[model samples]
Target chain A: MRRLSPPPTSKLVIFVVIAFFLLWWVPFSHVLPEGFPLRFGTYRTFQGSMIAMWAIVALGLNILTGYNGQISLGHSAFVAIGGYTAAILMVDYGWPFWTTIIIGGLIAGGIGFLIGVPALRLTGPYLAIATLGLALATPQILKKYDGLTHGTQGINVRPEVPASPDFIEDWFGIKLSNDEWIYFLALFIALLMLVLALNIVRSRVGRAFVAIRDSEIAAQAMGISVPRYKIIAFGISAFYGGIAGGTYAQVVGYVSPESFNFLLSINFLTTIVVGGLASILGSVLGATGLIVVPELPGIVSFIPGAGLPDELSWAFYGAALILVMIFAPYGLAGLFHRLVRVGPARVAGVLTPVQGAWLSWRERRRAPPASPGQTGAGSEDRSSGDQPGTE
Target chain B: MEEFWQQVVTGIATGSVYGLLALAIVLIYRSTSVLNFAQGEMAMLTTFVAWSILQWGEYWVMFPLVLVIAAGMGAFIERVIIRPVEGAPVLNIIIVTLGMFAILNNVATWRWGGIPKGFPAPPEIEVTGIRFMGEGALDIGPTVVSYHDLTILVFAVAIMVALYVFFQYTPLGLAMRATAQNPVASRLMGIRVGRMLTVGWALSATVGAVAGLLIAPLILLQPPMMMGVLLFAFAAAVLGGLDSPVGAVVGGLIIGVSENLVGTYTPKEWLGPDMKLTVTLLIIVVVLLIRPTGIFGRRAMRRV
Candidate 1:
């Protein structure tokens, strides 16, 4: 039997070191000399901040959809709540930015809990539609109550967005631009949330989530309060969404009803699935990919004599999404893990067993045919204990 | 009282269009268990095809051709894009449909440009010299309804009846129904399950195309025109029941009527016309709270 374990310690250390270096370098890379090859633009820093904000929501969504097997097309509402909370606190009540993030998170989590109680009855597509209702209603609710949300015109927080403290300039000998400062702020919060997500997925609470997802009855039999854990999952996920929402306000310095539309929720679901569901790293990778993939045409156009029209950018994005789903069903992180495990030489052997596992698992749940018993038995042997389906 | 009746009449006309699209969505969901988010986009694309055909051909001539083309496109998509990920996780299939949505919408915008085109309704058909559909309104008791809205309602009813007949009486429909109920059993019984699925897509696309054709004249033809209707239709499908065809149509009618009524009758201060959509969706959520499987959906039995 093959035992799955982390990569060798030396390789892990190198990976961590490189990741840390990139995170540390991104905010300051804009400061590099104009002609330097390593120099990145202020725009890239801003994009990085957006990616960080998006990743926070992706992390929360993955916990619900990926780990807990609860699909939410309504996360935009939670994010909106968090964002509005932050914006209202900062702009209306004169609250500091950092404290507002926590408040936003708490408020969002509370509402998530309320939604979850009702959601306990729904499963699969039904649950998905129920949450989708939340997403659909968010903008209307935001617009109808102009007194609170500032209506369709949206709220601007640019003046309230905090500038970098003078201590940073004195201590680090680096004077950061507004975009760079925002990027660092978002990145720091993302890192903190990422660590918390990692811990949550590894702890006892996380195990309950996975078990409940696998089989609710089985989880209940194992003394896991299914509803409690499921609701808790929603709360935690919404808290993360709220935190990201607060981060969005800090980063974008604006909030509007239109910003939290249905498409945003759909994109969040796409991010987790495309990133690799049930993965912390996949969430980050997906958020980065979501931001970067649309820019691919622009990036490719830089090549001499090779260009894709800007109008076709969305078409290209759609094609990329399809190709990725067909070829790399487990997502970019899954592809990355597979490469790391097998190395480049054995890459061709990637699709067989895992795909077989999913197919056979589905078949087994349906009425098993007696004719293909041999192949079915063979497939079941490899997939019995470790299927990745949400059955 | 007159205004209330008028809203109801108008609501039924619009709701029928919603029902038509929702019926298409339900058709795919029932047969393949995959919610085609791209259903509206598929319809929109076929309507564009119809618009192009109309440039040279007559209205009646373009109609059947567009349906055939739409059916073929649906089957082609099922075979090429959907086949590979057939047995994967549900989320994977959903994402693929969304991908298709993006692709179709973008391609249509790219091909046709974003300008809203004037797509004529099924041109004034003079059946028995009575003028069935044309640029005129008919008074029925307390309310006057436009010929286009009446045409939409008629098309919707005709399609529903045809579908009911197909599913109940035809051999091909039986095989498709069997395939939907139990693919493994249907395969063991020598039904070509794959062929049935392809046919299902073809049938669903035909229904959706009818919806697009009927609605384009009301909302004008554009790439993004179906975005709002698609959401409403999705809500309609869920409201009626994902698997029940009748439920989808009934759900659509209910939503349509309630939306209009809510807009007209609700208190104007905080929850009036602007809040109608929110109220309608809230009603759906409330209904779902009572019936998780939808109003007409069968409760799925689990063997835990």
Candidate 2:
């Protein structure tokens, strides 16, 4: 089987340059025609930055969970660590913005490395349970150390104003507000991190991670240092989570234990799962799903008396997750792949009734006959067995 | 010394609740390698069902009825939701349970509102002072043991004995154990493995409901009240070994004692009340580091 080669490095370079230009100029008030209803200036910029932050976190999680197959329920703990570190540095030490962000990532990465050393020994549910404990414990620890974290009261952080006048006006087409400057900074960091993640995934370390995910024992047998790789994945993930946390703190201008609860962890997991697990583009999709799906009820509430109770959204989200797991196990990324594969054929009118019937028959014929005593009625086995490239 | 004894008794009582939930977790893990993260929420939901039933029925009538309803609910959930993902990756199963956690918690909140509800204690059992260790120097210790502690201890012990007999002596228990150990072989021997798995879930839910009911009086019942308990229960389950029932009980006791002791010694400003969860997590980490199999759990030989 021939592996699909990634698009050329020159193409990626061109893409990055174009992306940077668009991110900077496309969100400006002067760029859009007057009275363009779809023209969202600052809001688009802010949302784009938030999406970028989530993409970074998802990419980090992809390394640990998607690549290494090690489940972590405590990724948010690292995020909290990053947020708190940045908050403390800015508030207490008066550290420079860029310096604090770097320090935040370092602190989170160090913590991740230490945790991974002990935690990587376990696998599957044990790892999850351990991480879940860590997630629960972090907020408490933060609250307990009130002198440092400010307890539940949290620490307020003022955003750093950009020093460059040309850069600021070019981006926003006006004198940049503190929030706008922070947003652009976050957007730049997110884009840089995303490119870095893409490069890493294409590198040898990424292949080792995939190998580890596919089979730990086999990876080890093939001379892959499982524990070391696992730790590296955790460290890298923490770094991204840390950046995301720092960015979020900068945007919100507040850091609290309540902000980094177990629900956030679950939401993050939901984002990754719904977005497309291992796929890079899927991370963005997942983050969108996380943000958008929760707001669906709020959107619905706009209709005259048609809105569901706010609590119903949680249940709906839960049900949506279950349905996705059951029906679309490969997630929206997989759905996109399937659509891409079938789109041309469908458009060409090749899927006629006779052709469809023949295809169905062939599919049935190709499927291995069920064994005796196999009560294979559920759709789960079908989805699992149909998963690409497994068998 | 008296305070120490009082803490020990309190620990045992709290440990009993953890043990009950842990036992349920182990049972589900035994049959289906899925750790039910929703166990606490499910239990809490069922206890609410029992609470609703008690509005009309007598206390005695509602107690047994609630257990039955919980068992049925457990079995139904296993059949409807968990059965589909029985053979998927461990992570997928975990996510499924988490989904269930969200659903059940939301459902409870929707029905009961987010406010805390008081758990009613039976009038007969409301006697304040029934000294267990005599009333002299023992009562003058760090924390005095209450009548509630003795009642909880006795109730926990009774449940344990009943469970022991149910699993060891009953044919259904033997069949369930056989299925858990080797599902294919059990199926080949003409046992209904799927049904047994469902039964396991039912039994687990019943035990979870019992734990919920037992603890509700001590802690006010709320939609998210059981979340904390679930963490401790998960720690207890891991500490006792994921596959062993007896291990869950012992693990719970160890966790309960350690949490109390740590809470007592740690400065009020440090971990404080939240130390219970942190201490439990620390114990779990330590246990996994030293002996992944857990105390009283048989070492599993993994094929490389």
Candidate 3:
């Protein structure tokens, strides 16, 4: 059971460091001989930036919704605020890009804290409605302040060419396009946030959040200030959203209320759930799904006649969602944990009775006439709660 | 004064649409503590079905056909997508609904395209000699009313009364309320809890479908048509008291009328037309601060 947990942090860090070096060689995949199906493309960079950007936002939301036990259908408003703040500063004040991002995040965090003060008393459905209203109104409010947001015309930034471009050209003798710049910068920020999130989740503050989520009354009895922690959680989460939004504005080189709609908020929440609630690694997996799920048909187009019809993707996507929820309530992270933990348990005789009963049940299903008595006993055992699913 | 009276009448008529949609929301919430974020999209899909039926022939036939189809669709959605997440964490249940929202919106777009098609409404109200909204000397009365507006008001009331009777009088409705109150107790009493939930979804869907049919003609049919209507309805439900059916209706009427009056009376310089959505947010936040359970909702007591 001890070994079943993810590998030690130091070892995992070493592995990631090695993988980081390996990533440098990926861009050269295009030089492969003709007829080789695999290749690297600029689209991959854009997709990579999207994944990193989404991961950042999803992680933020996971803290508020997952850890803190609040529902927000309007984090997009925070994202918009962060984005517009950075965009306005850049377009109007000519501030350094990095400085503007920090300020943008601060503003968003402040607003989130303010919203949290009132939100502390509301329950699930009511909180969700408030956030939903925020998502709907953010765009209109942005438009209303035409003097600042440019009123739907949107504000665009001049292309940014970071120091990494020069370093890439000097070291690898390759040009760093704008997409790659955004991707690497986003990657750096996402990694930083992931580490910060991982630290926070395992810390004392993180434990307080989980306590409140599990049972607010119990948490209060344990001397936790539920409202204070809840507000702090909201602020921290908004800070994450704001940073992600600032980078997003840079990635697209434009900022508009249209960019952060309710759909974006939903997708952010979806990724966090599909990835795994209460897990940092789950945020990454969920972000990947958010980018890939809609494009599944195009990704699988290589197989003959396997592409989903354009009109039917939603039906299939919906069906997939229902199936995943039924079968994988813990999402990708839960499945991975089970595979690791259960695989060893089976090998080490930890689940011998259950395994034996399952194998015998399978054997009986294959040949019913000869195996009635054995299967009946197995069913009796299952009824008494030795099945793997009973837990 | 005529303009003010005219706006008041317009408010109630328009508010009726919000009332009906709010009832749909309350039905599901009462049965299951879960909020179905996909309610509007579900209604929109069925309305599109009605639009297709209209292609076959006649106007009135689409209403009955849509109601039947929407009931089944609602039940199917509950069993397929919603039921599996039952008793799971609240967050998981919400995620399922959000997924449903995405799937429904995308499917509707694929089928209906993004275009807003002009839907011919039931009938125009023939006006005799009354010009009220424009200006000057005139009488502020229901005599200036349109047939469509009359139908909206009538339909909203009739459905509310019918629903009230169903819940208060019928055994099935009582069982549903029981299931909502306590599933274990309901099961002990020989009520089929799962079937009751499916029925609840079906009934809620039917109500939403009616609202959809009524609104589609007003907005012209489109995939995203019900979004604004859904928002207002949500406000109505919350304001009237989320757990109270009567509260939802009253909340809806208040929201509808106030939303109009504020826009009509206030200066555009202070609160623009876009402020309507903002007003909704303000109402939701302020209401929760003052009375978290809403006007008609009973306060929930929690035990440690």
Candidate number achieving the greatest lDDT relative to the actual structure:
1
TM-scores across all candidates? Answer: 0.93, 0.86, 0.87
Off by over 4 Å in 1: A1-28, A348-391
Clashes of 1: 0
DockQ of every predicted complex: 0.75, 0.56, 0.55
Query: Ten consecutive residues with minimal summed lDDT in candidate 2 chain A?
Result: A1-10
Per-model clash counts, in order, read 0, 3, 0
Error of 3 at B236 (Å): 2.1
RMSD of each: 5.2, 5.5, 6.3
- Which 10 consecutive positions of candidate 1 chain B have the poorest summed lDDT? B121-130
Clashing pairs in 2: B3-B141, B3-B142, B3-B143
Identify the runs in model 3 with alpha carbons over 4 angstroms from their true place. A1-37, A160-165, A168-175, A343-391, B120-143
Model 3 iRMS (Å) reads 2.1
Q: Which stretches of candidate 2 lie over 4 Å from their true place?
A: A1-48, A159-165, A171-181, A303-307, A344-355, A358-391, B122-144, B267-276
* Candidate 2 residue lDDT tens string, B1-304: 7666666777887887888888889889888888888999999999888778887988678889998999999999989998887776665677788889989999999998888888765334323674342112234346656555555566656766777787799988888889988899999998999999999989999989988887887899889988878878888888888888888888888888878877776777656567767876887788887886677666766676
Better of 2 and 3 by DockQ: 2
Tell me the native contact fraction for each prediction: 0.70, 0.60, 0.57
Model 1 Cα lDDT, one tens digit per residue, B19-131: 99999999999987777889999999999999999999999999999999999999999899999988888798899999999889999999999999998977687878788
User: Better model by TM-score, 1 or 2?
Assistant: 1
